[model samples]
Target: MGLQTQLRRAIAVYRFVALGYPVLLGALAFDALQRPVAAAALVALLIGWTAAVSYRYTRNGYEPKVVYTDLAVTAAAVALSAWALAVSDRAWPISLGPWLAGIVLVWGAAWGRRSGAVAGGVIAVFGMVFRGGINENTVNEAALLVLTGFTMGHLVRLGVEAEERTRRATERDAAARERERLARDIHDSVLQVLALVQRRGNEIGGEAAELGRLAGRQEEALRALISSEAYRHPLDGRRDLRELIGRHAGESVTVAAPATPVRLPTATAQEVAAAVASAVDNVREHCPDGTRVWLLVEDDGEAVTVSVRDDGPGIAPGRLAAAAAEGRLGVAQSIEGRVRELGGTVQVVSGPGQGTEIEMRVPRPREGDADGDAHRGR
Candidate 1:
């Protein structure tokens, strides 16, 4: 059941327990004969308050302000019960039995351990003040309230964490399956055609041999792309994009990032890292020998950015558009497509002899966001 449903059920159980308080007062009404009307009025208030709070709890989602107000009212009712009984000289105790303690538990279960502890302590002290002194019964009641609140709060937090883990695992599994399907398609169709073109071009000779070499290189790039573990489940629960992107640094490639971690969702970091890797690959393919590449990662709180730049002779204007028209889809699909899937933007900045830079910016995921859907679709 959902957390709210569990809360509602627990509240219902408390209401049933609260029912006995009125019954107890009715059975012992004769004991309060000195101030019978006052005792009866207190009893009516307790029952009515319980009913009204129960109705409100059933009709709404958790409202902290309202819940806290209920707690205050519950404490007040307990206080009044003690005052009325004391004035009437009743023999029986003025304690609300387990009813008041349940209110503390609900507070804890709804808000968390801290709230529970405060509510328990507050009501326990009030109960002591009304009951004359702190004795074993009151002590036990207070301890139970604190314990129940702390324990239930932890359980609720754990349940929420477990639900989140399950959702992420499901999305991770779906993404893995999709990647596998794409790998199979690439291997069966594109890889086979590339292999045929390479073989035919080699047999025909002349400029065909040069075309075969380019086709062979592309086939190898495609193979490496499919073999990447970027789609696999992340190593840690939270991902640091800096580490993933920094791993690309080599003899000619330099990585620069902040000393502090740039934290992101695992799947998002992985995809961004993969896109960065593709940018690096483009640099490697087009840049002249001895050319150096630099990767810069930054997190400005609102968004995370990774820029891949190479000190190589850059292409003239319309080169990328021309490549796209000629059916070379690396920049379009690998870099731009991957970033777009994450609800991010990728900008390619380059000009003749001015080097190339692919800068990708992905905004930080917001709280309560369903980021798993994006990963699954990828």
Candidate 2:
């Protein structure tokens, strides 16, 4: 059950327990009492209110306004105790005695510490007003009421927060289990089929060799997607962009980065890395096998810029527009989409004879960010 429901039930139980004190005290002092019928009627009213509040609060919905009303009713009753009760040589105990605590708990459950404290103070004030002045007993009761309300209010807050955390953790655990089941199924069937197609297509030649390469790429990507315990990129914490870009180095690709770490938030770094991967993939798909590619990462104060350069026959004017028209979105979506999503920009520099260069710029993480990853290039 939620914290509010549990607290309401506890308050209900306390109301019943505390109700006995005033009823018993008043009954024992019946002979010396003033206005016996009114006292009996007030006790019955308290009973009816308790039962009604308990029934309503135990159900699904709750109205915060009810707490305020409850406090007002209890205060009015306490304030009238002086005129209603017998004024003999001995001082008669008030009707609500410890039952006042029920109001405090109700306030705590509905709101929090501040409301609880206010309820406690108001209850104490009404009680003192009924007695005409303050005394040792009144002081002690006031302290108890205030402290109990504050403590219970703080506990309710902590309990609700813990319950929310537990719920989120359970959801994440269930999602992970579902993903693992799907991964097992894909590994057993689709991965094997793709591997077979790649091998057999390579055994044949001509267009089959191209088909084999495509199948191999799909198999590699699918395997990585299922096995990695991360999102599209590792975004759990801080990461160095330089380390991620360096992974693209190969026989035909060279990476140039600053001597110092170009630190960025995990999400920003991963997005930047994903965009770079898309650019490298674009080069590999369109250019000749032996074409040289260079990747450079630079920190330009307010922003970080990474440029992917390829020494191949450059893109012709209007070539990208025609490709987009034909629904090919390698450069448009994969490269440009990823960069733009990060609140960054993408610039394509190319011509008919000159080589192509795609530069992506992202805002540098500011100082005092949680990751503490804002950095400059050496």
Candidate 3:
């Protein structure tokens, strides 16, 4: 549908047409050398067929049906060549042209190496049968044709694969640019206003103070959401679990993690971090003032688990389901969504008048897993 795609189809059609020219020439030559009257008539017929097929293909814009018709034409040409070789005295040499032409057809069509190899084998068999013996020159010609066909076919296949990869890369780059643009626009306009409101409300007491606190919380969440660092660039240096948790700890918040490093995918780490932050925010919102929050990270080799617990009022029965129904979907979208996207799971244990505990478990990469490098490349 795109210009490049249309061009590629046109190129394929042209290659198909161009390949037939040599076969047509060889067919006419064979007829002239062996049957003069038939040679003239066959040449006329070839011209007419070629013109008709070309017109149909050009008009159809290289539809699959039109392409198949061209393939039928090639098959007919191959049949005609075989018939001529069977009847002619100089069948051995004359057959080589058609064999080479068949190889060209297979290669130009972008069939894989196996298809070309199969064509080579069939032609070689016919050559040996027609000549009644294998000679050095015949064997050499066969080998050359086979190699040429295989190489050309592979080259075409590689070109197609490379083109496809380029197209996907282009699309991905475009999408990334769009996301970055949206992030910038949100930060410039909405985030700036939120920040101003939060700061102003903090100065003015009463209802404005409550609004300011809410604005501040929202601003923090938005900042975390839009921060490129939170996305965890693969090329950036890795951080140990202890260091990562410590960075988020506060005077009222205690972090407990293993001393040793727990390697993880960048995405996995970021999601876990965001989930921890969300859990912390929820505890602050629902718990008694000045209640302590504890963060724990455990690395069990097979999986890494992170838990955020607060001795605060826990969720009531059916509260989560009710919240979801009411479109209060922050926890579901922010925490659960993040964990699920990383191929991990999240569990919440809570009850009315009790404490809340949020646990997230992410599977560890196996030894020598290719995904280790994939994370490093993120």
Each prediction's Cα lDDT score? Answer: 0.76, 0.79, 0.63
- Best candidate per lDDT, number? 2
Runs in model 3 deviating more than 4 A are 1-32, 35-80, 85-93, 96-111, 131-133, 224-227, 230-281, 288-309, 337-345, 360-378
lDDT of 3 by residue, 86-199 (tens): 435453433435324443434333345655555565555555555545887558756865776576557656665566556656755675677678789989988999999988
Point out the higher-scoring one by TM-score: 2 or 3.
2
Tens digits of lDDT, candidate 1, 24-67:
75466656555567767877777777777777777775578778
| CA displacement after TM-score superposition, residue 163 of candidate 2 (Å) | 1.4
Better of 1 and 3 by TM-score: 1
Worst 10 residues of 1 by lDDT: 369-378
- lDDT value, candidate 1, whole model: 0.76
TM-score of each: 0.68, 0.72, 0.65
RMSD of each: 6.5, 6.5, 6.5
Query: What's the true lDDT of residue 329 in model 1?
Result: 82
lDDT of 2 by residue, 126-198 (tens): 7777775698878778898888788777787777767766765675577667778888989999999999989
Superposed by TM-score, candidate 3 places the C-alpha of residue 228 at a distance from the truth, in angstroms, of 3.0
